[model samples]
Each structure stands twice: as structure tokens, then as C-alpha cells.
Target: MKLVLSPEQRHLREAVRAFLASASPLPKVRDGYDPQVYARLNGELGLSGLIIPEEHSGAGAGMSDLAVALEETGAALLPGPFLATTFAAIALTRVPDKELLTGIAEGRIAATLDGTEVSYDGSAVRGTLAQVLSGMETDVLVAPALTGDGPVMVAVELAGPGVTRTVLETLDITRGQARVVLDGAPARVLGPRPEGGILDRLCVAVAAEQLGVMRASLEAIVGYAKIRVAFGRYIGSYQGVKHKLADMHCKLEQAESIVRYAAWAADESPAELPEAAALAQAYVGRACFEVARDHLLLHGGIGYTWEHDAHLFYKRAKADEVLLGPPRNHRARLAQLLEL
Candidate 1:
């Protein structure tokens, strides 16, 4: 299939790329996502409204359009509450919650998922999520919980009491995670879990990011290999090095195909989105980590140093691998989808 992004989509991707390159360069990204920077990205750039409907004052973009934006963010290593808020929008837009949807479109709320062990006892919600993505500065929390019937999603406004958020010391500090403690917190049930295939759409979003990481790291490694000299010859001139680079390039292309297909399926083919997402994550998750690892290895000793950008990509790749679920988990899901 010939998969080409529309000019408008390409423009959006380029704009985000330029914005992140100048605004949130690799050196400035540290400790955690900058709140001021996030404000500019969402409010000024209108990125938060990309997927929300026009009635909600959003761009009314499709998943394919959102995926392009996500790819650019991943390449730039732009850290913030973008992912969490997008997930929140994905769920809220499915229901008739115009207020929350409008707020999301206008970039008023920062949200993240509390994947901690949430359990509902008919009357109250209780759980302690150890690692919430971008949870420190979140205004709302979209959490999945186990119920008597099955699983359900709840929206808890963090401005209220009964919810405690403790920032965690995570591996990738650029996009910080937090420990969220909910003790009988009052929450609004957004809808049934997986409403409008939010999880699958989310998986596609992240997989698109992994594709960006793969491509970015591959380009970086190849560029370095071309310039770095050893034994009076460029490192890339060596057969072994060239072979590894080729393998990485092949995997990156394979991942791009799956990522694009998954994004398209998110909007056009709901019935196929789950399998598409699972396949993309299963392959791209491992591929991203491997590509970053190889990028580091090919860079030699400096790659292991903290000052190197390779390490940053490496950490993000690792984080993306398990952000939704690890490669193994996605692979298992894929098998289940295939009915194998």
C-alpha cells in the first residue's frame, strides 16, 4: 500500500518538529517536563486540540494526523503531559461529556493515567499507582480500575481532595512519573473501559512514537558512523558496522509500515485497529529499544556517558517499550488477536 501523509499533516509535523527543536532541545529536557514549555506547546501551538472534535473547539483531526504529531514529539524527545492528556481526550470524547472534552480541546487540563492497582468496592475507589506518566502536574487522572462486572475507567479531578500525588524518581526524568495514592477518592466514571477503542488508539499513538525514535536514532548513528574515523577509515566503511546499520534500517522501515497502518486503522477501521496496534507495538517496541541500543554501541565510549544524546534516546526507547505494555505483552495480545 502506498501510504502518504497529506500536505496539511506534513505541515503539522514540521511545525512541531521546529517548535521542539528550538523550544525543548535535548539539553534543556531534564528532571521533568517544563510546565511553561508545555503551556506554549498546548496553548500556543494548539497541539492538545489536535484530535478533539470541532464542536469542542478542537482541530477535529483524525488519528492519522495525531500520529504525525506524536512522531515529531518522539523524535524531539519533547517531554510533558501530552501523552496523558491525549489519552484523556481519547476517552472523554467517546462519551457525551462536552464540558471535559471542551476543556481538553482548550488545553485547560493536564492528565495522565494512574495504572496503579485500582480496585472498586461498590462505594469507593482505592489504589496506589506506583508510576503515573507525567502525574506531578496533572489536573485530572484517567484511571482504569477493576470492578465487580469487569474493568471501568474513572476521571478524578486532582484539584479536589482524597487524592495524593507523589512524584517518583524515574529512569527517564524528562517525562516524569509519579506515585498516585487514591483513598476513597470520588470520581466520575467516564464510561466502560476501552470506550471507543481508546486503548488501541493509544497503542497506535505510542507505536508511532517508537517509529520516530527508531528513525531518529538510526539517522544519528549513521551520521556519526560516517564522520567518526578509526584506523584511518570511517567506521561505517567497515563491513560489520555496515551490516548492523542495514539491519537496523530494515527494521525501521518495517516498523514505519505497521505504525502507519495502525494509525490509519484507528480512524477508518475500528474492527482492525486492535490487531493493527498490537502488531505495531510488538515489533516496534523491541525494535525501538534495539535501535537505540545499537546507536549507543556504535557511538563507542561516549555513548555511555551522560552528556551524550544517545543515552537520552536509549532511555526513551526503553520507556516506550513498556509505556503501554512490553513487547512480550503486545506479542501475547497479538497471538490472542490472531486466535492462534
Candidate 2:
């Protein structure tokens, strides 16, 4: 498949890149930027409602467009809860809560999907959902859990009584994650437990973001290699470094192919979506992390220091790889899906 983006999609990516250039440059993230800033921007850009139907106060662009927008955001390392908020928006689309969707589109409310947890009693959830992108400041939490009816997602207000949020000091300072405690908190079940494979859709969306991260990391490293010198010549001139860069480029292209395939499959609901999502996540996760680390090494000691932004992406890549589900989990799923 060519995996060519539509003209509108291309425009969307360019527009988002332009917006981030002016509003959400890397410095903003380095300064411990507030997520509400992007939340408000999302409202203004109508991104919060991109996947929602026009009748529901959304652009109704669908997953592919949203994935393209997120790819640009990841490239810029735009601070805030873009992914988490987007996931929340997806969940809201299934519910009859017009108020919730409108609130999200207008930036009046923040929401996140806690797909990591499987169950929760009133007081606490027994499992750990790590690296919850955009979990820190979201007002609503949508989580899938096992109920008598099967697996279902329930929406809970974070500020409601008996809810506690503890912020985790994470390596990716630009984004935030928090462990939420729900003590008999009131929750509204969004819909019947998803048995027809809704979680697979969510996974593909995450893999799309990983693809963006990998591309950005690859670009950064390649750019740095051309400028940084060793042995009185640019490091990139060395054969050893050239091979590494070649490998990184190849991996990134492979990841791009899989990600685009997964995104397309998600939109069309193809039989290949499950396997594509797994392949994309498994490969992109590891490739992006390795590329980021290699980029750091190319920067020599400077990349290792906090002053340099390389480590920021390095950490984000690692965290994102393991966030929704690690490569190992995805690979296992692929094996099962392929009956291998």
C-alpha cells in the first residue's frame, strides 16, 4: 500500500506543525509547561472534537486525521495531555453525554482514558496502570473494567468524592501521570463492555503516536550527526556511525509503514488491524527508543546532560514504549493473532 495521506491530511499536519512552532516549542516543555495551555489550544483548533460528529460539536475527521495531528504534536514534543485527551474524546463519542463532548471541545473539561486498569473497588484499583499519558490533570477518567456484563468502560469524575490522584515523578516531565484512587466513587458505565474489539482500536491509536516519536527522534539524531564532529571530522562521516544511522532510518521507515497501515485498518475496520497494530507497536516501540538513545550517544556527553533536550525525548520514547502495552505484550498478541 502506498499509505499516502490525503491533501487535507497533509494540510492538517502542516497547520499543526506551524501552530506548535509558534506556541509549543521545545522550550515550553523544558520549563515544566502546563497541560491546560494545550488543552485550551485544542479547544481553539477544534481538535478535541476531531473524531466527533458535526452534530455532536466535532469535526468528525475520524482516526486517520487525528493520528496525523498527533504525529505532528509528538514531533514537536508539545507539552500537555494531547494523547490522553484524545483518547478521552474517543470514549465520549460512544456515550450519550452531549454535555461531556461539548465541554471537551470547548476546553471546559479535561478527560483521560485509563485503559490500563482492569478492575477497581470503591477504595483502590488492584493493578498498576503506568505511564498514563495525560492522566495528571484530566477531570474525567474513562477506564475499562470487568463487570458482570463483561468488560466495559466506565466514566468517573476525578474531583468526585472519594477520588484521590497522586502524581508520579516521571522521566518525561513534559507529560504527567498519576495514580488515581477511587473510594466507592460514582461511575457511569459508558456502554456495554467492549467485546467486539474496542481495545484494539485504542492500541492502534497509541502506536500511531509512537510512530511520530520515532520519526522525530530519527530526524533529531540524523541532524545532530551531521553537525557534531570527532577525530577532526563530522561523526556521521565515520563508517561505524553511518551503519547505525542507516539502521535507524530503515527501522523508522518500517515503523512508518506499519503505523500507516494500522491507522488505515483502524479507519476501515479491516481484518488486519489487530495484527497491524501489534506489529506497529512492537517494532516502533523498540526502534524509537534505540534511535533516541543512539542520538544521545552521538551528542556525546552533552546529550546525557539535562541541559540538552535529547534525554527528554529519550525518556519519553522509553516510557511510551511500555505505556499502553510493551513490545513484548504486543508481539505475544501478534503471535496469537497469526496463530503462529
Model 2 over residues 55-127: C-alpha lDDT tens digits? 7677878778888887877777776767787887776666546777777777777788876655655333334
Tell me the RMSD of model 1 versus the true structure: 2.1
lDDT for each candidate structure: 0.84, 0.76
Candidate with top TM-score is 1
Top candidate on lDDT is 1
Candidate 1 C-alpha lDDT tens digits along 1-340: 2268888888888889899888898788764578888888988779888988998899999889988988988888888888888877876666536777778778787877655548876656788887878888788887787889888877777767778888788777668787888888888776677645767888988888888888899999999999999999999999999999999999999998898899888888888888998998899999999999999999999898988999889999999899997789989999998999
Question: Which ranges in model 1 have alpha carbons more than 4 Å from their true place?
Answer: 115-124, 145-152, 192-196
Candidate 1, clashing residue pairs?
A: 116-129
Where model 2 places Cα greater than 4 Å from the true spot, the runs are 94-96, 116-132, 145-151
User: Residue 35 CA error for candidate 1 (Å)?
Assistant: 1.5
